[model samples]
Target: MGRKNDIASAVIMLGVALFLAGCPKQALEPVGAGGPQPQAQPQQESPAMTPEQPAMQMEPYGGASGQGAVRLDQARQDFQDADIMFEYDSFSLTAEAKKVLAEKARFLNAHPGMKVLIEGHCDERGTAEYNLALGERRAKAAQEYLVFLGVNAQRLSTISYGEEKPLDPEANEAAWAKNRRAHFVITEG
Candidate 1:
């Protein structure tokens, strides 16, 4: 009985030793042969540039000549919302243009007192007179669409700037496409 008890105790001790040997170390010790271990630290990040950052090139706008005027930022937003476009020498609105005009009309209808001036533009392709006429047609097209969409005609007007007010002055297809557009300007109280 004494021998059996000794054997059992030896077996238990052997099992515990094996189990501990197989387990991962709970405490880490620094190695004397190598340098100190690196401490974890938060990484520093570079500053990010945002839209509020100053533009490289800024154009200056003169003060309003009339009684009531719209903010330049608001005008820009209106122009974006308008999205008026024309085909080569065509005054008719495309399906997409009509959709955009519908939204514009809805906006104008909502703001009954607001007045908008549509400025017709042209690419530097046709004769000055022809371009002017084309511009008028384009502006009128947008104005008519607004009227059709229930915006009061009395609250809207059209102007033909022709090729004079080119959004992109470059003589490329992209510039031409950009220049050939009908833009919005708020001209009244």
Candidate 2:
């Protein structure tokens, strides 16, 4: 602890000295023709340069915004878009789903401040009640896998959307496959 304090003190002293040295002499000078003149007019800031607008702004996958929110939203979309599929009529995650969850776990671990909601969805087939139950199972399956992969359980929540929302609304095998999956939304970052 003594050594850490000494190092911290030295760093602080060095920073103060550098800051003093970096002071502009012109700033101290009187404002006159013989002294430093007024600066040129400032240019308008581009949207990307603004603090409120991120440079890599993406189409938000869900409603989330604030400091580091764009990055959080992107991460959420990337996880949900990993194609973590389940077998027809089953809530159990496949091998591919495990692989996707592993990647999501890594992402979540890196951003400990982030919180997310996992939405469970299903293909249009079973009765509404059955689909809702299946959806909950699917969401739980994902949440459990994430917890096993070392993500904090407190940072995750689950919801069952059942078949109410579909990525592809068309009545076809392709659309059904698209709809039967878990989705992610970032609640905080």
Which candidate number maximizes TM-score?
A: 2
Which numbered prediction scores highest in lDDT against the true structure? 2
**Which segments of candidate 1 are over 4 A away from where they belong?**
1-76, 79-81
Kindly report which residue stretches of model 2 are placed more than 4 angstroms away from their true locations once superposed: 1-76
Model 1 gets an lDDT of: 0.64
lDDT of 2 by residue, 127-189 (tens): 889989988999899999999999999999999988888778998999999889998776765
For each candidate, give its TM-score against the true structure.
0.58, 0.62
Tell me which residue pairs clash in candidate 2: none
Candidate 1 per-residue lDDT over residues 24-138, each given as its tens digit = 1110112122222222111212121223222221112111221112233354366555658888888889898898888787656534446889899999988899999999999
lDDT of each: 0.64, 0.67
lDDT of 2 at 143: 93
* lDDT at 129, model 1: 92
